[model samples]
Target: MKYLAALVIALAAVPATARPQLAITFDDLPAHGPLPAGTTRLAVAQAVIDALKAARVGEVYGFVNGFLTERAPDLPVLELWRAAGLPVGNHGWSHLRLDDVGAAAATVDLDRNEPLVATLAGKTQWHWFRFPFLAEGNDPAMRLAFRHELATRGYRIAGVTMSFGDYLWNPAYARCVAKGDTAAIARLETSYLADAAETATAARTDARSAYGRDTPYVLLMHIGAFDARMLPRLLAQYRRDGFAFTTLAKAESDPVYAADVDPSLPPAASLRERLQAMGKAPAPRTDYAVELATVCT
Candidate 1:
């Protein structure tokens, strides 16, 4: 009885395993990259929306670049996305890199995107700002200034914690589809899923290293044709890997996202950022860029 009581106490003292949480967010909506043959921008949007709906994911945010809607054909993608009960946030007007343009120009660019976002977002929270190319700024002072600017504008920075360069596959997939290369497309699918799974494992491992637990992750993706085609399988794989889908707002509500949820806080919202500040190096990720670039050519 004494031994059994001690065993029970020891078991109770061990913490329960933390289930990984993720918020899937899409960028470069209305249009992302070259569409596959026979695919329209609206069709890509519809496919992505269908996948999300089928998966029963909630409140996924599609970050919008208003410049794309200047072309009439691309406008309906936003309409279809909104009609499907998804939310839209700003990704800047021209998708300009803030580091390339100075803070003043980037601020103007961000504001230019607001009118369209405000119209489409309606009553939803449309003040989430995702930096184009995830480039906050090259300069520390500039980054801090831009963050303050975001806070003043009542915007939360949408920080990306998980990504496997999903955008890299879109152009290759398009090339493969154009050439009618089913074998190459199959290769793309395999590589895409492999990278996603590998990156998710790396992200969780890095999170544990930085925070001693897995913080809720916000996944960065683009609404490209390949992404639309693969989202259902991608989401299912995450589920199998023990990730529970969450809203961006809910994921950012975790304390690790304090800087992202409120830009007034000092920047430490990402594992890499935290590790860098701690004088430790973040784990290196496999770059598929070269392989993806040359695959279908």
Candidate 2:
């Protein structure tokens, strides 16, 4: 009977499809913005890359600082990344936030990042651009304007519909557990997972609303402190939820993704600033304590 049970488990592991059908994309790697003032950006980024490798996460869009390119030319982080078979996408030069700037400035930001990504990844075109806060800018006409710039540059501007909400002020919240503060740590863990769940659900809904089909999501997460801790559990959770992780190059290959665009001359400064203004939607509640107070024990 035990042998029969083991055989059943083995059979279940086989692919149900000749080719896997689900796809997911990662945006904003190296998570933090330009190495917080007095730290080694290179070392930090390398650690993050190592974590990504360990997690077995296939591909993600990277927005690297030009400084890293200048200082760590031999690292082959980009080459290794591409060799791992993931397309490199531009996050922006200097990793500047667009909301602080305008269209003309936006163009400059885009130019710097794309070219830098090109320099590092050996790809002439950047497949995706994820804004710092997902906060590109709020003027009604500005959205179209930014898209036009992106189109000209042969780039797809990723609008993140879901996120784990790590950027708002992580570490303090996420590390509460390992630090042995049960209340803070417990809430942090729950919040981290719950935030993703909420984001995924919203993305699914938005995809249905916008595309009239449940469009797979482009999840925006930084390769940061909390994310490193959260990845293993998060990945397992997603797999159980049946979502598949995919490279940016692969994601861009789909027609549903609208990947075709001309590689126009390097974008202008105005456009780059506007690009920085792109911000993400507000996060949903991770109020696990209130929601599951009864069983949290």
Candidate 3:
């Protein structure tokens, strides 16, 4: 008992900054991919919101493509999201790839999404922009030009530092549910958690190597049905791993995210990007794509 009490006191003396911090953000709100049987868009949003609230996660940003809301049933998903006090940001009007469409078309697409975001995010700062597919263009000059464009529009680029391809599991999960493949769904659940844990370790290792410390991380997730189902457990796992949840704005307030938060600085480089710039290899992670693709097929 004495040893336990001493250990608790020592840990309490450690600063909050010394602990790993993570901000969770979801993309493709309103609609992501094919929904599982009997699952409504509103239900998915509600489940995700409930999970975040239950975990006491602060102000998670859900990037929206307003195009999805054109389908009448999907529009309420955004309403429910905002009603729950979550913030919405622009994910392009149609989730266009800037590289494929060029800067002119991409900027127009971005502007088209602004009004909906403005309406939903009334009195809140909604100028954060997350690139669809995280593609900033195929060349440096093109990327810089787009960065300048975003900067002029009072937008901050949301940089992703931790991701595990959570979207990949959704389709497989939907398929398994449709087919009533209970065993396959069980396998998917186990693999999903395992991959998340492994990727997190790899991201932390890379960050420490690149920055000589564990910087605050922004984890990119999708608002798919499977995500809603797994989020509560996922939040528990992150807590068990000793991560304190933070808002995107708070996490990006760190100096490491300055470029992302201020587009005028330069194109943002994530931890892996910094490692590549330094001519060092990033930590290796398991590739679950092939396995995910085959599951429930």
Candidate 4:
């Protein structure tokens, strides 16, 4: 019994170098949330770029919703991301949720964004498609149709392994900044980092439970003011957890990410959801309402 106890302690002491890997990805690029007081799109993008560079993250994938460009024609925000060494992908033209618009409409949306992506990304590959709202469709048939279309079109589905309700905090942060609520802003920052840490832990737990080992994680974040603000600290948390950042392409290349897809299967929007779909228990939910209610209505 003492030998077994010693073995357990030894295992516990083993370093996290054997822990799962992770890749950072951003959606709703060029812009995401309403700008906080005294912030511009350029500033937000620059903050994100600088944070990633400082962390030594080699590449990040930014999925774009082309419609935003129609509003701000002069910024060349996609070019900024490309120039900074991030690749762009299609998140549809208007960020259509497939379940709402159907596969046919989603196809149109994808096509509408392609020319702009081609122009912006230049020779860089831009074949990833992240489902808007992570909803493929409510109908199995439509879901299969969409998946088949994506396969034939040579687009890989960008799966999300980790996310918190980071999007929820953006507008709240913007409101806090607008009102000069320094205390509220501090609370927002603390809660956001906590949420990120919790979700990253969840991703590690769920991946092991589902796959019998760690899988390379694809973390989903948006390009927003608060996300930019929290990014450096967030990356530091991952570093402490023994994660080494890589690109989305490299993460997806892991064999564990090659989990078989059943076209008829319902939407497995996230890694946790995918595990649940396979009848496994994922990490217990991380509640976002507690954080959002503190600052946002």
The lDDT of model 4 is 0.79
**Alpha-carbon RMSD to native, per candidate:** 7.0, 12.4, 7.6, 7.0
Candidate 4, residues 144-225, lDDT tens digits: the string is 8888777777788788878897898899999888888898889888888888888888878886676555667889999999
- In angstroms, the error of model 4 at 58 is 0.9
| Model 4 weakest lDDT span, ten residues long | 259-268
Q: How close is candidate 3 to the true structure, as a TM-score?
A: 0.93
- State the local distance difference test value for candidate 3: 0.88
Off by over 4 Å in 4: 1-17, 73-75, 259-280, 293-297
Top model by TM-score, which number?
3
Clashes of each: 0, 38, 0, 0
State the C-alpha lDDT per candidate: 0.88, 0.53, 0.88, 0.79
TM per prediction: 0.92, 0.64, 0.93, 0.87
Query: What's the distance in Å from true for residue 282, model 3?
Result: 1.1
- Expressed as tens digits, the lDDT of each residue in 1-297 for candidate 3 is 554354335434434476799999999988987799998888998999999999999889999999998999998999999999999899999999988888888889999999999999999889999999998787787788888889999999888989999999999999999999999998988988998998888888897787666778899999999999999999999999888999899888776666788888755455566688899998888889998898888
Tell me the spans in candidate 3 whose CA falls farther than 4 Å from its real position: 1-16
What TM value does model 2 have? Answer: 0.64
Which scores greater on TM-score, model 2 or model 3? 3
Clashing pairs in 3: none
